[model samples]
Target: MSETNPSDAPSPSDPSSPDAAFAQAAELQRTGAYPEAADAFRRLARETLTLNVATNLGACLIETAEFDEAEHWLLTAARHRPTEPVLRRLLGNLYVEMGQMERAEVEYRTGLAFRPQDAGCELALAGLLLSLGRYAEGWPLQEARAGLNPGVVPPVEVSFPEWQGEPLDGRSILVWYEQGLGDQIQMCRFAQELKARGAAHVALGCRPVLADLLATAPGVDEIVPAPRGETVRIRDYDVWSRYFSLPARLGTTLQTLPTAPYLSARPDRRARWSGASGVGIAWRASPTGFNARNKNVPDDLARRLLDLGATSLHPEDTGVADFADTAAIIERLDLVISIDTSVAHLAGAMGKPCWTLLPRLHCDWRWLRERTDSPWYPSMRLYRQTEVGDWTRVIDEVARDLQARSAA
Candidate 1:
C-alpha cells in the first residue's frame, strides 16, 4: 500500500486474490465434498491455467466419476509438465478408477521413476500388480503402504520390534488386523500356520466386533480388541506383525494357499440358527462411495432371490448382532448368495457353500480375473458380471444354479 506496487496489485492468480479458487477446491476435496469440489475446480480451471490447478481439477473429476473429462485434463496437464510426479500419480489414479489397469500401470511407474519414494503411487502400483496375479512383484512393493503419508493413514505407535519372517518358535507374537473385516477374516487363517511353525503363543489385536467370532478360530491363544485411544498391552507380546504380512512371511503361493473352515461358530448360536434349508443372501455392503459402484447387487435381483425361496438373511434383515450371529445363520443355511462383502468372506472362511457376485469392473484383487472358483476358499464360487454394471447375467446364472441345486 505504501507505493501501490504492481506486484502488490490484486492479480487473479495471487494467493490472496479472489480468483485464487484452487485452495477452496482442494479443501473441499480433502473434506470429501467431491461434487462441490469438482464445480469449484472447474471454475478455477476456466479462470487460470496452472499445473497444480489442472491436476487438482482432474483429481476432483475422477472422484466425481467423470473419468473422460479427468483423463482430458490430466493428460493435458502431464503434457505441460511431463516430469511432475503428482500429475503422473493423479493420471494413474484416474486410470485405476476407470478400470484401465494397463494404462494405470504405465502412469504409476512413470510417476515413481521421478519420485521413487512416493508411497501412494507405489501402493497403487502394488495393488494393480497384485490384482493381475503378479504377487512376486506386488508383495514387495506393498511394503510402501506402511510409509504412506499421515493424511492417508493415522500414525500407529509401535512399542516392539516388527517381526520380519524371523523365528517365532520360542517367542510370542502379536498379529494386528490393519484393514477391514473381510481382510481380517482372510488373514486370520495365517495364525494357525504361525502356531504350527512353533510360535509359543499368538495373540490377535483385532476389531471388537470380531472378538467373539475369532475366539472360536483355531490358532489364536488370546484375542485383544484393537486400541482406539486406549492403552494396549502391547508388552504382552515379544514381537508384532501385521495380519496381511503373514502371506509374505509364510511364503504363500497359489499352491500353498490354505483352504477354508478355519473358523467355527459358537455351539449355542449354531444351534439357534440350525435347520434353515434356504439360502442366506446379502445384497449390499457397508455404504461408501467406491463400494457403491461395484459391490451392490440390484434390488430387483435381491427380491428375486427371496421370491425364488431364499431367505432374506442379510444382516440388515436378520438384525445380525455380530459376526457370530452371521456365522450361526451361515452354518445353518444350505447356500449363501452375496455381493462382495464381509458376509461373503465369513461364509467362505467357514467353508459354507457360497456364491459371490462380483462386478465386472474394478473387482477386488482377491477375486482375480475370470475365475469361477476361489483358491483361497475351496467352497466359494464366483459369479462375475459379464460386462460392467450388468448384474443381470450374474443373477440369471445364479438363479438357474439355485433352481437346479434345489430341484436336485
Candidate 2:
C-alpha cells in the first residue's frame, strides 16, 4: 500500500516524477475518478515502469475497458514481478472480461501458487469454477471470500458457530443475506430447507427493502431488517451460516433444486395494483455498487418492448418504496421481462413467468452457460445475446415469443 498527501500538487513543468505522478494517479483512483486516474497512470507508466504504477495503471485501463493497453501493461508488470499474485489476479480478471476462462484459470492458479493465501485469486478461481458449473469444486473455494474487503459483498461476522448442514432438532440458526437483493431472494429458499431440517426457529436477516417482501417466504419464522451496507443485528441465534452457502453445505445439485414458488406476495398489496394481466417490464437496473456492468440492458429497451403492446409494470413507476411494493405489482402481471436484476429473482421466487435477457459477457453463474432456462427458478426463461452488446437480437426473439403467445 502507498500513501500520498492529498494537498500536495505536482509541479506543472515536470509533473511526471514517479512519486508525485503515482501519488496523483493513486489519489484519482481512490476518489473514484477512474478516467483521470487511467490517463495519469498511463503517463506514469510511459515515464517509468514500476510494479505499482504498471499494476495500478492496468487496473484503471481494465475498468475503462481499454483491454489491449491493460493487457500490455499487466503482462509487463507480471513479467517484472513474476511472484506478485496481485498482478496475476488482475490479469486473470482481464481474461475473464475477454471470455477466456482457461487463461483466466491459469492466471488465478498461478497467482495462488505464488501467494497461497491470496483471497482475491482464490475468489476469482471459485467464481470461474462456479461459472463453469463445477459446483463441487467451487463452493468450498468460495469460503475464501470471507473477511475480504474487495467490495464484492459486505463482511459477515458472528460469534456463534457455523452450521454445516447438520440436523437441528432443538437448535436455532441465523441465515444472513449476502450481496445484492437478487442474491438474497435467490438464496432465501434455503431458509425453508433449514426449517424443514427441524430447526427450532429460523431467523432470516435481509436488506430492509426486501424484509417485508421476503417475510412471506416459507420457513422464515423471524424477519430481521438488515439495512443495505449496515451490519445486521444478530441476536439469540445458536448457530449461523450465510444463506448462499447453504447449497454447498447441503450438497445440492441441479437435480436437488427446491420446489418453485416458495415465496408469496401480500394479497392485500396485490389487490391495490390489480388490473388486466398485462406484461411487466424492467430494463435499466440500479447502477449502484459492484454490478454496474454486464447485467444492465439498454435504457431504451423498455420503450421498445412497449411499442409491441407490452405495458409498463415496472415498480419504479408506482413510487415503489421497496421490494414489497415491487412484489405487489409483479403478483398481478401476466409475465415479467427484465434484465438481470432483483425483479427477475422476485418474479421467479413467486413462480411468475419471467424472461431474463442476459449479457453475452460475464453472465451470472446461476444462469449457467448457453441455457434457455434456469435450474434455480423453474418458471424463469433466459434469453442470451448472440454477441456482446447485442440486445437487439435478444429483444427480437422475446418480441417474437410475445407475439406467438398473443396469437395463441
Candidate 3:
C-alpha cells in the first residue's frame, strides 16, 4: 500500500490540541513509522473514537500486519459513516491483505454501489475477481484503472480509434505497451491471436530494452520503440489498444487463454549462453516500489538456492544489457526459479520450465489464488506463501521439489 499523505490532517492553533496529536500521528504514518503511528493513534482513539482516529489507526495497524485490530478499527469507522466509499475501499484492501477474498469483493462492491465511479474501488474489485478467475466480470471493470490518480495505465495520445473487438481482417492494430516489462511479456502472446484473426499487421509500441526481445514474438510485424522523453507516433495502424486490454477485447477465459511459446531467444544469443546450466534464480523484484519489500526474498534465504547449484540471473550480477540477454540465458538453463517478476514472465513466454514464488500480501492477480499451476504458462509451477511475510515454508517446498525433480 502506498503511504497516505499527512497534508490532509487537521492543523492545530495550539501545540497541545488533539488536532496537533492527529497531525503527529499522520506524519508518522506517512513516514512509514507504522508502529509509532499506531501507538499515537491508539492513544488518540482512547481519548476520542472519531472517524479520523479510527481510520488512521486502522491504516497503521494494517501496515504492521495487525489484521484483526485493523478490521476492528476500519469497521468502527465504516459504522460511523456507512456511506463513505473510502472506508469501504480501506476495508476491501484490508480483506485482501488478510486473504479474505470473498469479504474483499463484498467491500469493493459496496464501495462501488455508494460511488459508482470510484476508480480505486473498481480496480480493487477487478483484481479480486481476476484473482478468483472470474475473467468475464473482471476484465470490463479493469478499464477503471486508467481513472486512478497516478494512473495504472500509461498515458498515450493517438489518432487511431481504440480497438474494441472490431474486425481486423487485412487491417493494422497497434498493441501499445502499458505497465511493466512482465506485463508486456505476458500479454504479447495476443499478437499471435490477432494474426490468426486476420490482422494484416501487429505492431508493438514498447520500451527499447524490450525491442529486440519482443521483435521475436509471434505475429509481430513492426517494433515501435517507446523511448522516454520522446513522443512516439505510429499513425500507420487502423486501431490501437493497450497491451492488457487484449484479453477483455478477445473475450479470453482461463480455458481459452493462448498458452503457447510465442517468443524465442535468437539462435545466436542462445548459442552465446549455451554454457549456462542448472537453475537460473531471481530472488528479488524491482527494489524501488512499495510492494518490493514483500515481493523480494531476503538475501540470506535466497542464498540457499545457490547451495543447490543455482546461478543468479540478476542483470547487475550477470552484466546483461537487456531482457534479450536474460531470455538467452534462460533458454540455456534447465529451470528458472524466480519471484513474481519479469524473468518469470519471460521464461514462461518462451515455454521454459519456471517456478514462481508468490507473496501472501499484494500478490499479482495473474497468479490467481491457491493454485500450484498456471494456465497462462503451461510449463510453470507456482509456490505461494501460506502466511503473510513468511518465505521459509515456500522456499522449503521449492527446495524439496527441485531435489525430487533432479532425482527423477
My TM-score estimates for the predictions, one after another, are 0.84, 0.86, 0.91
Ranking by TM-score: 3, 2, 1
Root-mean-square deviation per candidate: 5.7, 4.8, 3.9
Which tens-of-lDDT digit does each residue in 1-408 have in candidate 1?
011101100011225445436667766776667678779878867776666566766776776668899898778777877777667777777787677778989998998998886876787787888777787777777777666643222345677777888888878988876667877888898888999888988988877889888888888899888655555555557888877678777777777787858887888787666666678888887764345556788799788888998887666678778898888888888899988888888998999989999886557778876789888899999998877668888888999999999889
Give the Cα RMSD of candidate 3: 3.9
Which residue pairs clash within candidate 2? none
Give every collision pair in model 1: none
Residue-by-residue lDDT tens digits, candidate 2, 161-272: 8888778887998887777788889888887778778888888888788888888988888888876556556776888888777888877767777957978778767766
Off by over 4 Å in 1: 1-47, 60-68, 96-100, 147-158, 227-229, 288-290
Alpha-carbon shift of residue 233 in model 3 (angstroms): 3.3
Better of 2 and 3 by lDDT: 3
Q: What's the C-alpha lDDT at position 82 in model 1?
A: 77
